[model samples]
Target chain A: MSNPVSERGFEPARHAELALLLEVAGTPKPGNVDRRRDLSGLCFEHFLTGAVGSAAGLRLAEDGAPVGEAFETAVAGMSKQGGGNTQFGCLLLLVPLVKAAVAGDLSPEGATRAAEATTVDDAVSFYRAFEHVDVAVGDPPGDASDLDVRRGSEAESALRAEGLTLSDIMELSAERDANAREWTGGFARTFRAAESILNDEGPVTDRVARAFIDLLTEEPDTLVVTNHGEDVARDVMDRAASVSDLDEAETLAEEFVAEGINPGTTADIVCAATFVALERGVPL
Target chain B: MSNPVSERGFEPARHAELALLLEVAGTPKPGNVDRRRDLSGLCFEHFLTGAVGSAAGLRLAEDGAPVGEAFETAVAGMSKQGGGNTQFGCLLLLVPLVKAAVAGDLSPEGATRAAEATTVDDAVSFYRAFEHVDVAVGDPPGDASDLDVRRGSEAESALRAEGLTLSDIMELSAERDANAREWTGGFARTFRAAESILNDEGPVTDRVARAFIDLLTEEPDTLVVTNHGEDVARDVMDRAASVSDLDEAETLAEEFVAEGINPGTTADIVCAATFVALERGVPL
Candidate 1:
């Protein structure tokens, strides 16, 4: 297939993949995997493998593959490495961004438009992706238990019967899932964090770390809320807000890692923001 | 352009780029950048940037762009990051291997055939790449002073007059440059190291570290020979040979970093070997 994206000499898929790498490599990410640390079940190498493995799927998106097929392909490839859900939310954010980029724009509006255009097949594929890895998600609302992501492919019938587009499904979860919020809310937090990253000084990794901390401070991470309670998630954000510098952030990183307090949703936002910053020509 | 390599469901370019990332991420590589340490002038993030930056050029090679053009383009793109020559020699080896992989065969013979098929124009582009970064090299032999790489594009006319292909230029420096030796010797060391990496147990990063130590022990690094003397290179090999485990390797890593004794040529070979290993299905 002729790739308009490639023809324009812009590699959105590569930029998205690099964003995943840079986000993971950014140190002192406060309980997230980085160059210097790994969680109990995940290592730094797993992130590397996930970033690399996701390339084929990302390229498929760049080549104008259907959003659902591209996302499912990417999730499958990403899960090939043993790091169960290394970049699921990150890819959730990136796949649509890539599709938007392929369509000749990568703005927040462009991404939202792309997300809005996703078909019921896209919803099916997104659900199928959950089968590849164990993603920590809150309980589906009372009215949508049949559409629980944990049901994976089993939710396809319900999704198709209701004629719910991928964006529609995301809207259903927008009240709780930070990643789904980006789909429904035009990626406001992601784009804001991208600006923060572009404006920061020093190395790109440091910039990402700073952005991650800022993001965590600004919002209670949904993943943390699901794993812990709202009170604990609020406490986590309060602690993040107090991190004044990288040294302080490093200390908090140790504490959070020890406590198993991974702000994974915020980290996913950082990954998406990183892609935006890179696409905007933030120097490597 | 239609990419036959991508059409075949293979992504040699991404594999090569990941090889660069994995090589740099492998811990305690004695004298090279890794997850645990960085050289004074080059940080870990710089390698990450270099790996990401080289993607476009790698894609060019995968799309069947001329070997020389692709190599030069990759070098240029890799140099976009501030780390200066982070993966120059690695790219030299990778460009042809990627080309070979794109052609449906990634064997040593295929790589050699790709290398040997280069024309005088390829030689010009290869020298042009030297202009983009400060690669360490010994003095050219007396007979080929006019074609010295340091002369960069200035030696284009001389290369053309002498009818020297990129492989022919490599043959001249093969005795002094371990990377060039791979080009002349059909990547024997690279393939052998790939075997070692694949056969070794534990994480892929650990396997890479093991292969790196083994390679450093087996041969005096050519970059060390250029920066230090042949005697110092031999001493480095001896020191590497004495490293019985990762702990000892870590100790040596501190010493090498402190003393500015980077065995870069060996690291380049390790990167190339990593690509081969990944291609051969060494699980991430």
Candidate 2:
């Protein structure tokens, strides 16, 4: 038991170190553009509770809701099997799954219990039911130094399933998405490069990251199109138009990592670059 | 104005379309290894903020603190520039960047007023700001829409001053590393991953989105060791011993993506595989 997997211990220090190296190599946000998982725990807390109570909650747009009712329209749309998220969305309705993971077996009592336990606490409790199951925790992120920010695979799947179904059950999913793209809409992205020149080629800042997220938001059919658009732009336009102050900041960040400098000094320089970009009001 | 940028009509519809797609695509919680950017508005915030404060609010990890106080220890070990994240951590700071077209050259007071607005309000304010600067309200996005995400090469060449002195900036210029092969702390990752598997991951019900976020939490260095180690094991260990069920999920995910599923769905399916792997608690 004491031994690491037969493969033995993996050096996580490598991530920080590579981050350090990337800092040194050129302070870019690194080639890997990370897409984060559902981190809006606060809303989720509310949504989960609503899911248990009313069996759903509104999925809002950056602007607000769409014209009509949230739930009825969506359930009708997703279940038709001809929609954009055909197989994926409807999977949530499988009563068997909810029974096994959420409510545990076919019974109105089970469904009621699931509904009752809809908040994060309920989700966590529901998650506890699977401890004996022989599933991997996905990427195996073994860091919980911080309670909220630590995890890998496992329970997320169940939660996602629960989330999907409840969302469908309520139908806020469609209404919430009332405003997608139209970056300048409610959700605008403002990116900056870290180099001396001002352009778009650089790390993923709020702007760049938002743009990326937006382009890929929903529509399974457009995945490749959005991805290719982003890739092409990153390759050609990034260097030509990245926000340079960002580039400079990255350069500084790289040096700090290579030298193993303290975190504070590094933060200041990064903040300053961001402030400059903020001052400029990065275009949406 | 009939222009889409104007809120009364044109722009809102475009946002609706984008939202429709994302709702359909499904940002399902993936099952495998992933990390969560646990902060409220790290990226892809459902709402909007003005350029200044928005950019300043972002923190890399939940634990991040300002440099002067939190990084005192690093300061001693490093130069005026030395501190763990002195230069680096600052770069991770997120800033709010309003587009020049949105709100240009406002006094700090004007900027602040605009900043106070919500996403929709901000967009409206920003669109008005464009008039102050030499800009057009350009047509709304459509099949032939051309709202450019690109900027001119020399947008800010005028902003730089000679001999800028940064106290603790991170340096990203290339250089040799002390260790021939980079390494770092891995025990923590090992423990976390193990604990997660024990805690989450189960059969038939794993989610995708949340798990991937958790997986991203481990220091990338740990990933190289664990994953690259598996890669290493494949070369040296029994061929069959190295392959994993997680691989199956990954393959499934790739196939899904190839079929033009949303990246979020690909992430979901792939993450599920990872969760399954962790739940099973195989290959360290």
Query: For model 2, how does the per-residue alpha-carbon lDDT over A176-278 read when each residue is reduced to its tens digit?
Result: 2211121112112112222221244333243333222222222221222233333432332333233344444345334433433222112112222232232
- How far is B168's C-alpha from truth in model 1 (Å)? 1.4
lDDT of 2 by residue, B13-61 (tens): 1111111112211232222111221112122211111111111222111
Error of 2 at B9 (Å): 39
| Residue ranges of candidate 1 with Cα displaced over 4 Å | A1-10, A100-106, B1-10, B99-108
| C-alpha lDDT of candidate 2 relative to the true structure | 0.23
User: On a 0 to 100 scale, what is the lDDT of residue B269 in model 1?
Assistant: 97
Top candidate, metric TM-score: 1
On lDDT, the candidate that comes out on top is 1
